[model samples]
Target chain A: MTKSRIYLSIALLPLLSVPWFFGPSSSAVVLGFPIWALYSLAITLLFSLLLCWILQRYWSLLAEDESDVE
Target chain B: MSSEALIDGGGLVVMSLYFLSLIGIGLAGRFASREESLSDFYLSGRSMGLTVLFLTLYATQYSGNTLIGFAGRAYREGFLFLMSVTFMMAVIGVYLLYAPKLRRLAERFEFITIGDYVQHRYSNSGLTIVVTILAIVALGNYVLTNLKAIGLIVEAATGGVVSFATGIIALCAIMVLYETLGGLRSVAWTDALQGILLLLGCFAIFAAIEFHYGGLRSLGDQLSAARPDLWLPPSSAQKWGWLSTLLLLGIGIAMYPHAIQRIYAARSTDTLRRSLQIMVFMPLVTTLFMVIIGIVGLSQFPDLDRAGSENITLLILTDLANNIPGIEILILLFICAALAAIMSTVDSALLAISSLFTQDIYRRLRPDSSQQQLTRFGKILSWAIMAAMAYLAIQADATIWRLIVIKLELLCQIAPAIILGVNVRRLNAAAVLSGLLAGTALTLFLMLAGDPIPSKPLGIHAGIWALLLNLAIVFLVDRLRRPAE
Candidate 1:
């Protein structure tokens, strides 16, 4: 993916990272957490994974130069 | 805050041994030093390997606030404090915006401090001086917050056998001693140890909770039954607040002088990249556990006010000791880790402050100073700053969150300068300076106008509003400058 596209996608991740869609009236619980709290943490875990992927696959291309180090 | 001592003789022995090991590491780093140059003392000669780099970053980023204050915040705010996890990740995510570009420049320029980049990029002495002073103030506040945390941990661990003032003075002396002796090398080495302890500490909290109070499920049920307000979904204003927090912390923390210097101190780009990749997962293990502990505290002790809530972790551990046999060992381990977390952060901040003072502020006045002279001056500055912050910590009573907001508000004003300056080559120094000052003025005005004007007007933090104004001014000034050029 293009750097701009990658960044744009990362920018959108925070929207999901917050549990905005869950309303106050919902009483659902997952395991031992409120459903919204569970959703927030699940999304955060995904956020971590996706960021790791981006770092591994794209950072070398985006960074200035690698010849100086290795 | 508790009068009775919780830890007995064995725990005290473990604590003493931990302090001795840190001093030992400092001596080792002193012997390990290659030269009297500022780079050798401050950046570890830019030779930090992947393990040390990753661990030090983890240790530095998760401070005493993460363990104590954050849990307290969670207890008070409930599920809304889960925003803490998102904000922590945002700090690393924002790094992606600047770290790669900044790392390349740092290697090329041999940058010793964040001010070096500001000076090199802007080529404006006035802007550099202003940026340096802002960074110093922000970092000084960071040290102050962590110093207070150190006193709390020491006093709590000893069960008030050691007074708060004594804890502050003694730990401050030890931190300055090792930092002066070994500098970044010593600090990083100690941080690696502290990082492991911190991770284990989190796991201990999880294990203890599961063993005694059942699982998070039981705690969640209890909280819902007892304090239904906590389990309720966030309000509209809170949703807006979360988004605002994401923006402010995501961008602002990346500007931390100590964290930025870590980018310069990396052995290679690959190492830095790998380390940061791992860092993204940290909130899961560290922050999530703290949030859980806070929730557990809320469910168990429903009547705690704000100040009492901050000591909820200690309360939980003390309760565990009373119920569970042999749990005191794990509790002792957690206390050591807690101390490690607080000290690692303070030492790093002190080192950054000393470097910023000696290189950015002092060097500007006396350009003829030798590297050895500057390095020595940095050591002395660390001592002086520690003493002052120690005094302030003992006397002051502000909450950690308040200090965090103030520091980040000041630091975020400089983001356009550092973040945009790294990416946009055509960005002018005048544009950045104007935006920085305007943003800072608005934030200070709103924050200082405490009683009548709300700090988070309309549910959004004052810092985020200031940042919006800051960015708009930067864009406008850049456009005007383009026409003139």
Candidate 2:
């Protein structure tokens, strides 16, 4: 579920709104992986999963009950 | 021992190995379910979760065009090309309209095809069948454009060793084989691998470009010093119309039949919803990565023709390798990533078109056909369609934008029937059919009449023009025609 992985995907999201941000500072080394916008993407992805689960499950009159497995 | 021979040998090895891996992924279906269970085979048992769904959606959206075409446009156009980023992002944001509800219905109904949705809403076999086939054909052409781009870019990047027509046939044959085997599940799985490589390739090239030049800031400063106009928005000459873009992609991009089908195949509402959330911000990252490559190329290679803008990224990379110290490996990685983008899209599209034929056309006409029979038909349809596209892509001397415009024009016709169909219960099938036909006809007419929509069309894309008429007809006819349910 995205809820569980929000932290991970957020860690990977990239930023595209800015014109062009790649300077020497763009490749900030952290341990090994560069601390770039990709991290933010991963986190956002995770958050979306959690949010959708909450909204789809609890908020709306959308889903029919899963077919009985019997 | 020579540098040229050494680099050439390395590139060949990487290219050969990647090609073999793609076929193996295609063969992945043999270990999957037997052809007996069409549902399992085609829809991947409707069991994909957030990860596969997200990756598949990403892979399918980016396609070969993202690297070769969009990148090329950004290089030449500059700030106006930034709109390309916004348009793609807007597609994900628009998902909020219906994806949430659609996901729940798909799971509950156990629907594998978008036609099931259309058929249920309209209660009309004729309408559903027609829409389904339209979707298949539109998407077939969509994938074919990307396939054509792939062949062009590969041969261009490799320098004439691989002819464009031969490259298209070879790649398409690989796509058809894997897609015939694994279906949605295989596409999604491979998509995840491809998406990662795609992003890495982008970053690698970004790093390489920045490393060779000073960085983006210096590069931008250099570009600005040379041509300040590139940083500004489109002039009257460029025609980067905003409202038109909203309409163009709103109906055109959202109606990707494969995308809609993937929503149907979601494991749960949660999975579908999550996939869309990340989809919203995709432009900021993926599009940003590409547009920068384009802009950077402007500083690196000024005086490029309009078409040369597209080859800017590859051109820069190849030039960087040849002129700069030692970065041949980066070029190899770039080629791999680019090839992966093309193949990932090709396989997904092959599955989408073949599904349309098998389910919407074949099964609808002959409802009693068994799973084995239907899937056998699906495989045959897959190969046949691929062969046909290979022919069209190679022989057809149409511009890439021409193919994309025809594609969106056709896809725009289906938007009202699907997107609006979910909200309004009283929308009669006959009225919807009327609207769909009118929309398709108007779009085709307008498209045949004039300018490229994304590139320029009275300062608008043809899709926006067609969509306006599409929505207007849907509304007008829904009010005018009183068809009995």
Candidate 3:
């Protein structure tokens, strides 16, 4: 894998677990969702956009043959 | 949620017409067939373009569970089930790990079944057979689950005018007839139609609920006041479960045999790449909509018991049909979409099961069999398997989500063999074979051992633990094998 692709994957993992980091507060709401719920949704959308960018930019790199990997 | 017929005279007529159109497409697909070879039967002559590929993948991946089961889960679990959208996207994310290399290799090898890939990569007969058997069992369970859904929908839609057993038998016959007539070409064509219907269905219901209940903001306010626990952050245990679910679904679903075939069937690498890029955004529309609808149901009908919650989507629809003027048409559309979702998944799995049995097991036993003979046997196999699964669906009483977990657990065991095999050239047949066996054994032990052992220890699924062990063993075996060589 390329250094950039590896870095992107690492960045993506933490975003997937965003729900785990918040507290039990429903005191705040966003567009009909609690702060944590809405936060998780926003992070998921960001995760998807980043994945799309990775797919478009680094697809050829990811698709390279095993011989090219470190 | 009473046991009343949701569809009567005109509704029955529309549903019948929909059923007949599928068979019509089957006949059309047969005429469109290029040749009688297994390659043509299973992979559609390796000529699928972007639209057909995308729709087929979409329809095949999202089953009736996405429509009904997901809504029910959301109703029961509250917002924690929003993880449904994340896990689905994870399936697509995992696809990127190996689909590109696998697609190129499949084209070079002219692969027909997933077994063909395993056999080629490992050159080990035992490993190939084991993997194929694992795939068939998992897929067989998939067919059974969907078959039960079809039967329940028909029985409920008709208010017992057509019994559950009758529903299973009739739909099974329709699926097998179309499948045997046109093969994957017919299945993909039907899937495209079904995919469109599914999208329309989800959107219609989501709009109705959002408009009827003010908006998400209103619903959120109500939910926050009524069920404060739902708005709270996940407990530590729930966090572990969320991460575990992502691993199981992400890795397991990408390894589905029919899903692998779609990669090989693509007309070009660009077609496959574009289809998957578009798929990354589907969860936003498909799963997120269902999650919202489920929450809507929870807010509307707060007193339903656990079993009643599973039918929350149906309850919401039935309530709408009774009250909303001009909404019956939309309900009919949703019904057809639900059937489309169930039938589309069953047909693809049936085709995959037939190809695996004929190519992997039968042909291995009889090397002299020609492609014509194998294709003929595959047609016969689809009919036989569908009959057996339909019968089991009638007799069985297991819940759909439990069946889903069992299937994914078995299917995920084969991931190391396929995913690791593609990426690591030095990963040998023995390493994969040992890892697969160890993982499967551990999963079964954990699953069957009750009371003394919790089903999901520390809120993580048994399958996830087994998978971690499986991956560790694969690398360990590879390391040991290197020095010996």
Candidate 4:
């Protein structure tokens, strides 16, 4: 696997771990957002930014093989 | 005219024009394709750019259920339904496991369908056939469930002027017409428009809710006072439930036949990667909005029963149109967007089924058939499948969530063949085939024995249990066979 792919996968681990820290909590609101909602939004934003970075940098390095297209 | 009557008239006209434009795009797709080939028909000649690819992925991933069924679930489950956002993102995350490699292989092999990949990887016709049948059945259920949604939406939006039965038939007719007209090209083009409308509609409704019910602060305060339990942290068991759902939907959705076909349809690796990067964030705008809308519904209409809550989004739309000033246009647009979501899903699933049947089953049986002949067969198959599904949809009474769960239960079984086969070279075809059979059998047995939603014999999802056994069988069989030697 490429370095970026591995980085992306590791970044996704926190998304699943959301249940551990912020699972179904409504008592605490962060900046007017529920704890769980805020956690999710933060992780999603991180994921999107990381993915965009990977695509712009590492993804273009992969060689394209269009030999099979008829 | 009354407000309801005005909505019905305006919504019907907008939706009619929307449907007509879809057919117009289909005709245009037909004219643009220079050759009659399966690749051209099924994958739009593998020529999709970034914008169309991203939107098609968005449209297919977030169906009408995202708008209607998801909100209902959120209204029913409360803050716990925030798991919906996580799971939707997990679908994109799971793609990281295999999509890059699969895309490379697909380009090299010129793969058109998921079955093509299975056939190439396994070289076992039996395994290929079993996986293909599972895909077809899962996708068939998808079409049936969405057809039911279309009927309900039309019936409700038209204020019953269009009966449920008539609604199903008319929408199915239009979907099959355009799908048959230009195949994937047409479907992708229409999906772009639908995806945009869906996003707009979500924002419009969120604005309308704020307009009608003050703001999120007021709604949250009301909900906290009325239903404090909605905010409590999930119990250990419920947390497990959340994880199980994430795995089930994560792996299952990425393996969707239509999704894989889109992966193949991507014009370049960079295009596919960029599209997926954008897709990673859709849950925020789509599923998250639906959950918020549902929560707002809880505060606005606190006494709704379980079934009544599913209509929360639509009911809110109706109320807003009737009561709110200068919001009638937004209501009509939202209705069209909801319809767009449902139709986009139905058309994509229909096209995937037809391609699976044609390229994998029929063409395999008749290897001598020309590409043109196979393409024609696929078009006919699309119409036939839609007709059968429409007929069955009228009689099918399951909730949208239930129907989706049933499909995912079976579809999840194929994950071993797709994901494992792509990543693990030592796993033999026989191991994969046996694992698939055992997993599917177990899932069906458990589903038929009791309540279909919850996992049996354990707190985990039934499909996850089946998948565990499926993975076990694959590993055990692979070790015994020693295929690497």
Candidate 5:
């Protein structure tokens, strides 16, 4: 996939936080003790998505200038 | 805090010998390897693989707290302390946010400082300085917390030969020497050695305790009968608090300069990715080890007083180990691990903070400074910072979590500036500054008001409140700066 696609794919992980905010299980020891897995994954995916978009939109810079090559 | 120390002749010798060896290892790092340029200085040319990376990460992450302060928390709060284990597991997942992309970019640019990345991405010197300052302060607090642990070990194990001030000076000097000489390379290599000792020490002490107490099941039965809440997860105080904490600490702790600096230091994207994958499973081993130990304490010491709970972990281990035939030696080993944790974590912070000052702040003002000259001065700055921390350690605070939590509250405000700089072009410097100021003000207000223990409103962490306000202000101001799309 393109750079934007990759970044978005990552950022989307963080967006999962919205669902996490909804609620956790009453089964806390296995599920609720700390929210690192659920919340962090969401934030990471969200960040990656944003970064993917930026990289793709700025893709022109990735093109190598053959004439300038040594 | 009376030591209630069980140290005797053999224990004293083992502890003293370990200090000697650590100092010797610190000096050995000064023998420069046959490599050239900054990468060699900072990262040993990215030669570390999964094993070295894993050990380094493990030793770095656990630090003095696991052995010294964490058990104290566990003894005091009972089941509520397990939040530490869960949060650590969460810290692993938190890495997924930037680890992948950060690894790629770091390899691309040979980036060392998180400040450097922010500076390059945003082309803003102001942003770089802000990040560098925040990082230096946060790392400084981390060192202070670990230093207190160092003081405790020295006093207890050395029969008062090493006063708190003496221990701080000696350990800080050794750590700075090794870190400045070999950079991240030496630190990683030493961490590999130290991490193994740490794990062994944990398991050995744990087994000794369990065997003495008639095993895990019997211990659990005792705790459950006496303190049922110790076995169950946190109820009123902890459950309400975990929500904001999951987000606040997960993000804030991951932003440590050393953690991000490693993304740049990794040999390849695969190395970084694999190391992080391993990180995902570490809490199972690292966190559970400490939690189980803490729970076992409940059975051994029936009527443990609150004021003494902070010292309970050490007290119980010493008391139980003294009676054991084979385990007294391992208590000495734990002392080594304790020092290793303090040195490895603080040394990394010193080096990172120094680099930020030399590369980001100092050079920005004096662009023409020679690389050799700057590197020389960086070494000096590292020592200076360590010396300051040594002073803090002597007048140590007993409340480990308070120092760490307060520092994190202020440091969390950096997220909008550092994390958002990469993709959000509309996130103007003015907007970033506004967000930071607002967030910092809110955090300080809460802290200053002395909002009772644990949390304030809706069971949320104070940092989360500040961060929420910070982000909202960033976006609101950013929108005004560049109108609606």
Candidate 6:
């Protein structure tokens, strides 16, 4: 895997641990949202953006190869 | 408008037209393809571009379960069910582990079924048979469970005007008709529309819920006051449960037979990659919304039992339509989208089952059979399977979500075969075969004699335990055996 892929995978590790660490707490509200929910949504958004970055940076190399071959 | 009036009148009309359009697309698919080969029938001639590929993957992956079962689970489990979002994203992440390489292999080998890949990679017919049988069993359960959901959706959406038994038969008949007409092409084409509708319906419902209920803040306040436990962190046991679910669904769902077939059906590497990149973000839009709906349901309808909770999404839709002004059309659209999700999933599973039977079993049994003959057999098999499933759907007593989990448990065992087979060349056919059998036996044993969710043995999912044992057996056996010269 490329460095970016590895970094993204590492980034995702923390997202998976969000539930374990954040705990469901109603008192910890960020921007009128439960802490857990807000944390999850933030992680999800970050994961998406990071994934898009990985796709653009590394996966496009494969696409370019396909075009070259064609 | 009253719920009954909406369901029986405009709602029914819109759903009927949607069904008709599916059949029309099926006929169009048949006319569009020049060849009658299995590849053309089962894979749309491997000509699916990025858009169709993306939507079909989206539709097939998120079924009726996402809309109904997830919400029900969320309502029942509270904030803990947010793990659903993580598991769904994990499915996409898991795909990155094997899909790119597997698709390349698929293109190189002209692989039609996952069985073809197993047979090609391992050169073990017995292993191929075992893998194929596992896929069929898992997918058959898939069809059975979704068939039940279809009946429930139609019956519920139409305010029970269409009886459950009749709903199953009528909707299943429509699915089989179109599936036979154009196979994967028709399924994918219809899925594109269904996928769009599903997204639209989700957003519409969320918007309506926000408008009427003052968004998640009010709901959160109510939940905190009424159910403080729901706001607490999961216990240690629950954390283990969360990890187990993540691994089970993440790896398992990506290995779904229909999903693998979609990988094979991609037009190009670029198409598959693009679709997957977009797919990685889908849980954000799809499952996350459904989970929110369920969480909101906690405050809105505080006392629903397990079975009743599964109807939370529908119940909320109905309430909104009845009480809110001018949202009847949105309610109807959401109902149609729910049906679309269920039907899309059923058709994809049906096609996968047919292709697996015809390509893997029947063709192996009669190697002399032509592609045309195999295609015919596949069509006939679809009808037969749907008939059997519809019958079982009516008689079966398990909940939709439980049935889905059972399928995933069995399907996850096949993962080592495909995932390890692609990544590890040294893993022999014997190892994979033994691993598969052992994992399957352990999964069944645990499910039957152990916990209802099959995660009671040490709080981890039984499927994950089975997979661990499977890998252990594979590696141990491989170490003992010498490489072939």
lDDT of 6 by residue, B1-485 (tens): 11343365766777788889989998998788768899999999999999999999999999988888998998898777888887888787677667767888888899999999999989999999999999999998888888888887777766667878999999999999988998899999999999999999888888888889877776767877657777666777887888888889988898998999999999998888889889988887888889888888888898898878988987888788779777778867877888899889999999999999999999988999998998999999999999999999999888777778889999999999988887676779998899999999999988888535444488887889999999999988887785666
Question: Which tens-of-lDDT digit does each residue in B1-485 have in candidate 1?
Answer: 77777788977887888898899999999999999989999999999999999999999999988999889999999888888898889888788878888998999899999899999999998888889888999998899888888888888778799988999999898888888889999999999999999999999887788779986776766787768887677878888888888888887787889999899999999999999999999998999889889988888998999989998888898788888887878778877888899899999999999999899999988899999999999998899999999999999988788998899999999899988887787889999998988999989988889888998889888888898898999999989988653
Candidate 3 residue-wise lDDT, B1-485, digit = tens: 24678877899999999989999999988999998899999999999999999999999999999998999999888878888888788887778777878888898899999999999999999999999999999999999999989988888888889888998899899989999998999999999999999999999998988778765677775776567688778887888888888888877888899999999999998899889889889999999999988888988888888888878888888888778887888768888999999999999999999999999999989899888898999999998999899989999999899899989999999999887888878889998999999999988888889998987888789898899888899888888887664
iRMS, candidate 2, in Å: value is 10.3
lDDT string, candidate 2, B58-141, tens digits: 888887778777778777666456556656755654454455556666766766677888887788987897798788878878
Cα RMSDs of all predictions? 2.2, 7.2, 1.7, 3.4, 6.1, 3.2
Q: What is the interface RMSD of each candidate, in Å?
A: 1.7, 10.3, 2.2, 3.8, 8.9, 3.8
lDDT of 2 by residue, A1-70 (tens): 3322432332222123222333333544332223332343333344345334444443243222223212
TM-score on B-chain, cand. 6: 0.97
* Deviation of model 5 at B5, angstroms: 5.0
In order of the candidates, what TM-score does chain B achieve? 0.98, 0.92, 0.98, 0.97, 0.92, 0.97
Residue B153, candidate 2: C-alpha displacement in angstroms: 2.5
Local error of candidate 5 at A25, Å? 15
Q: Write the per-residue lDDT of candidate 4 for residues B307-328, one digit (tens) a residue.
A: 7998898778777867977777
Best by lDDT: 1
Docking class of 2: incorrect
Scored on chain A only, each candidate's TM-score is 0.82, 0.35, 0.69, 0.59, 0.35, 0.58
Better of 4 and 5 by TM-score: 4
Q: Which residue runs does candidate 1 get wrong by more than 4 Å?
A: A65-70
C-alpha TM-scores of all predictions? 0.97, 0.84, 0.97, 0.93, 0.83, 0.94
Model 3 chain B: weakest 10-residue lDDT segment is: B219-228
